[model samples]
Target: MCDGYVQCNIVALPEAYAADFARFCALNPKPCPIIGQSNPGETNVPLLGDFDIRTDCPKYQLFVDGSPTAELQDIRDYWQEDWVFFGLGCSFSFEDALLQAGIPLRHIEQDRNVAMYNTNIACQSAGPFSGNMVVSMRPLSVAHTIRSIQICSRFPAVHGAPIHFGNPKDIGIDDINKPDYGDKVEIREGEIPVFWACGVTPQQALRAAKIPCAITHAPGHMLVTDLRNAELATL
Candidate 1:
């Protein structure tokens, strides 16, 4: 029940393509770590334990015709027998680890959602799943920026390392102050923007695939899980 525990980003899709998506995550483990999974018609994620896949998550996205249809408080009504669940580690899971290491997160300090941008960098495609990578940004001093990358590198299961730093234009971002998703935070006199592989990467992929139907956890309202932050660390 620790707030610092890992919070996952879930994708419960029709079993016909679940395996393909899983393969996509496997191929790109940095952005999508498989922490828990479920077979067809099963609702529980044993790795997360005693979990109810339909409602344990804070919020959900319903996609119809490859576009977001509506937000749901809970998705029990849409649960299908042909569905399977895939749990990917969230960026929030590593924020606690970062804070513990004395790396202050600008968004958390400002009480805002992390800045996310849809990058021009395309992801490795799988059957019906291909899209640009989405990234989260935080502004910090140069020294702290390196430290954050070093600490995050230990948790490859949760977006192990930052994809890029410094120039936003290199990633196709036109403005450092304007983001495609989430809120922007002040850059301060000495801080530079740092980016990370975000959990929202899957959402970008889903949109590209244009799946007839897909379900995903909404931004910020991640699926809280039983895994502790320390448990996800690697040397």
Candidate 2:
């Protein structure tokens, strides 16, 4: 809900696995860009904002042994002494750049969550964390797609630019309408679906790691940071 600000994907896990997870993010920067993080047991990520990690995000996902077990508004009860939270750069941060560039996004215009899908593309493996990449799609005309690539390339910290455009099957997405996550939107007559490496890729990695317990921001529910989206632009 905080427009023009940076949004992050939350991934909190035990301190014991923090190094491996950090390495995983480093190896797969596009889908898991590390924006900010908190020390063990600390609920505050000063680098991101003056907010409490436990209660700041609108919704959180609880994962047990790589499987989602519950959804929560607040994670107070599940908080752990040795927990470490990593704030990953989110695609939402770059949408403002796209919008400002005059590139129309179908999902945004329809007031729906962007469609995300699992792809055949594999990420660099780190420890127990390894999985195929996930991507978010936006349908745009050829002109808009090219313009978006130019605009979004300036914001590399938030997934950079389009990874693939045109055929969904080129990236292993069997069906465009049946997304693995989020609502479906119309592709229109003259537009092609453009895909970007999504922050949700970490969740797929989390599931592969199969740590005993983990916490992540639910899809579309991100942590709003005090940082401005403009501040992240390289140009």
Predicted model with the maximum lDDT: 2
Q: What are the lDDT scores of the predictions, listed in order?
A: 0.86, 0.93
Q: Name the runs in model 2 displaced over 4 angstroms.
A: none
Each candidate: how many clashes?
Answer: 1, 0
Candidate 2, residue 65: how far the Cα is off, in Å: 0.9
Question: What would you estimate as the lDDT of candidate 1?
Answer: 0.86
Top model number, TM-score:
2
What are the per-residue Cα lDDT tens digits for candidate 2 across 1-235? Answer: 8789999999999999999999999999889989998889999888788999999998999999999999999999998999999999998888899888888787888899999999999999999999999999999999999999999899888999889999999999999999999989888999999999999899999999999999999877899999999999999
- Candidate 2 TM-score to native: 0.97
TM-score of each: 0.96, 0.97
RMSD of each: 1.3, 1.1
lDDT per residue as tens, model 1, 16-108: 889899988987777778888898989987788678889888889998868898999999899999899998888887888889988988789
**For candidate 2, what is the lDDT?**
0.93
